[model samples]
Target: MPSLREDGAHLGSAQEPAARRGQLRLAALQEKVMLRFLIKKGTRMGLLILFAFMGFLHASIPDSGADDMEDISRFMENAGRIGRNIEIPENLHKAQGQKEAGKLLEYYQSEAFKRKYEAEIERLKGTVFKDTIDSYYGDSNGAEKDSVKGGTLPGNERIYLFISSSVPIGTLRNYARDLDRLGDPNVFMVLQGFVGGMKRVKPTMDFVRKIITEDADCDIQKNKCSAYKVKVKIDPLLFRKYGITRVPAAVYVPDVRIMDVTLSEGMEGNAKTGDHYVLHGDASLAYMLETLRRPSGRRSIDLLIEALKGGIYHEVNKR
Candidate 1:
């Protein structure tokens, strides 16, 4: 009857530990195992801390010879793989050009490289010789005849070479050649034959005048290469006055003397052997521009020579 019915059971009654010795022993064993696990974990943490400290100390100090050797070995091994056993290839250098190579070493040593490059360029320029109406006199052979016609000349100066007619294509071509050799951007070959003389002449003359006034900043972008053209009548006065006793006669003029001197002075200067600022019909356009830019009485003959040589034209009447 007691088993079949739901009788009052001792649910609150406690089972004493001393009575269950096996269970208590098992519990004690589990606690000991947990303690051992925690101790092992602490020991592992201590070893990790010790390793980290040693690594930091090693890195802070200078590397030992052994360390350097290891690094060198690694670099050499990699370099060998890349085919860089000795010095780098000639092309594959910090400075590809001689100029750059010079900079890589002593800065002063680069001067030789500069000189060599310039010398080579000069040699090439010599190869590119020009034959103009004027350059015929540059020679020693028939130079006297050409010189006789070419007046006193300077190394580099803008000269206005007045031609009566722009008709003869050959003569115009020769004149162009002269301009090429002169390396002057400033040149005025006055062509007298064009119709609407003032209409054409005014624009060209005005354009050239602007160049003489403005210097390098002349309206080049505007198709106004007017630094190089002038106008005049097709007469013997233009010839005899400029010593165009022969075709292609050139006259030289100083930047300052264009207004005062007669055109004959220009002609004489072309042939004579002496130092002069203006070449045959050459003028100091750069000098005038500089003078205007910075007022100075000091003559910039050489500088002007450079500008003329650099190719700036100066016209005759536009003086």
Candidate 2:
């Protein structure tokens, strides 16, 4: 038997891919509609005036002389027809637009369309928006994450390089290079809080990426976000503990002993830490380390100084 299908049979139903594309279009349109709705009130009157002016320009209407009482009477008689003329065409267009809209609504709500797009929304969310959600909320909002944790740190001797976004790029670059050279596990670049404000997390993360990478132009997507050799972290509690106000400041805290203690009555055990040697300046890590060195010299501080003694520094530490 010969085939009875029409020549346009393939066009009768859209393919799976076409349906998915249509769903995306529908989603895009919905987002636009929502944005319009938000600003609709301000746009309505302005658009009406704009529409009237554009209509006059499009018509190329000639300037007519002012009408007399008789001419006004004539126009008043014709005004009813003018209103009727406008009403009929508007109603007709509304009917036609509504009919077409109904058909589109039906297609979008249909089982086939729903089946194509329903799973896709979640799939897109999981793949594309996974990091967005993690980097922005709950445990990952930067406020709750790792106030004390900066990769792995030594249990005893520690060096905290207090820094902020306001610090000069040159100063930051110096710190970056020297910290990499030092390569000490106890060293960390500490920030008191977010750069701009804690209201959003992107700015802070962006600042961190900008300072850490050697390349000025770094994009995460292109994999240019090079990881720092040293750990950079935000620790507000640590800032409070050490009373850090200004930067660039380095605090050498050594002889910290970590131990577990039993519970006390309505009291938390204080952190077991060593004496802190503080130095403040806009100098390199090696210089700061040298300046913060003890008069008699402890073994841990001596080791840190030895690590940076060989590195070249532009500015000397001591006055």
By TM-score, the best candidate is 2
For candidate 1, write residues 1-319 as lDDT tens digits.
1122122222222454554646655666677788899999999999999999999998999857898899999999998888855565557554567766455444322566345534533442243211221231133233223322332243233344554332354444444433443443334454323234422333433332332222345444353332322222222333444445333333434442232221322343432323222123222334333333333232433444454444534443346
For residues 1-319, write the lDDT of model 2, one tens digit per residue: 2222332122223444777657756766677787788799668978989999999897896656566767988888899888777743436588789898788546543676445533543443354334432232214223212333432333456678889988998788677767765656467688877677544456775676566666666555454343445556666656777777898888877654434321111122445675777888888776676677755276666666666664434225432
> Where is model 1 more than 4 Å wrong at Cα?
1-158, 164-187, 191-236, 255-301, 308-319
- Which 10 successive residues of model 1 have the least lDDT summed? 128-137
> Per the 3 Å backbone cut-off, how many clashing residue pairs does candidate 2 have?
0
How many backbone clashes are present in model 1? 28
Report, for every candidate in turn, its global Cα lDDT versus the true structure. Answer: 0.41, 0.60
**Least well predicted 10-residue stretch by lDDT in candidate 2:** 260-269
lDDT of 2: 0.60
TM-score of each: 0.21, 0.46
Error of 2 at 88 (Å): 63
Question: What is the lDDT for 38 in model 2?
Answer: 71
After best superposition, candidate 2 residue 11: deviation in angstroms?
99
Candidate 1 local distance difference test against the native: 0.41
